[model samples]
Target: MTTFDRREEGFENKFAHDEEMKFKAEARRNKLLGLWVAEKLGSSGEAASDYAKTVVATDVDGGEAGVIRKVIADLAAKDVAITEAQIRVRMDELMPQAIAQVNAGT
Candidate 1:
């Protein structure tokens, strides 16, 4: 392949890798968010883990918004009070930790 073609291929590969990392980070963030919400709802052990998994699954189609909606509805059902802004802020805060965890292969 020509140098230009090789460079293009490299760029494509980098883009794919970056996208994968972003997905992993977001999924991790969702899991963390779910666990936090679960704690607020008084879930522990296996129940908390299952709840976190559901949050991750929600992201498959709904992305962040769906997860937020699900958590908000759940918290409200349990009489826990939290605002959308607070959930968004927590998502932002968890992102870095999620990214670090993803990079570390944990």
Candidate 2:
């Protein structure tokens, strides 16, 4: 292959890898967020883990927004009294930790 063609292929591979990492990071963040919310709702151990999994699954349907919506509704239903902004802030805070964890293969 020409040098230009090889360079293009390298760029494509990097893009694919970056996209995969981003997906992993987001999913991790969602799981962390779900666990935090679940704890607020008085869940623990297996119940919290299951709630986190549900949040990760919700991402398939609506990404972050959907997860946020689901958690907001859940919190409200349980009288937890949290705001969207607070959840969003928590999500932002978890993202870097999620990215680090994903990079570490944990």
C-alpha lDDT (0 to 100) for residue 31 of candidate 2: 95
Instruction: Write down the TM-score for model 1.
Output: 0.99
Q: Give per-model TM-scores.
A: 0.99, 0.99
- Candidate 2 lDDT, tens digit per residue, 1-106? 9999999999999999999999999999999998999999999999999999999999989978899899999999999999999999999999999999999999
Candidate 1 residue pairs in backbone clash? none
What is the C-alpha local distance difference test score of each model? 0.97, 0.97
- Per-residue CA lDDT of model 1 for 1-106, tens digit only, reads 9999999999999999999999999999999999999999999999999999999999997988999999999999999999999999999999999999999999
List the lowest-lDDT window of 10 residues for candidate 2: 60-69
Q: Model 1: runs farther than 4 Å from truth?
A: none
* Reference-based lDDT, residue 46, model 1: 100
Candidate 2, superposed: residue stretches over 4 Å from native:
none
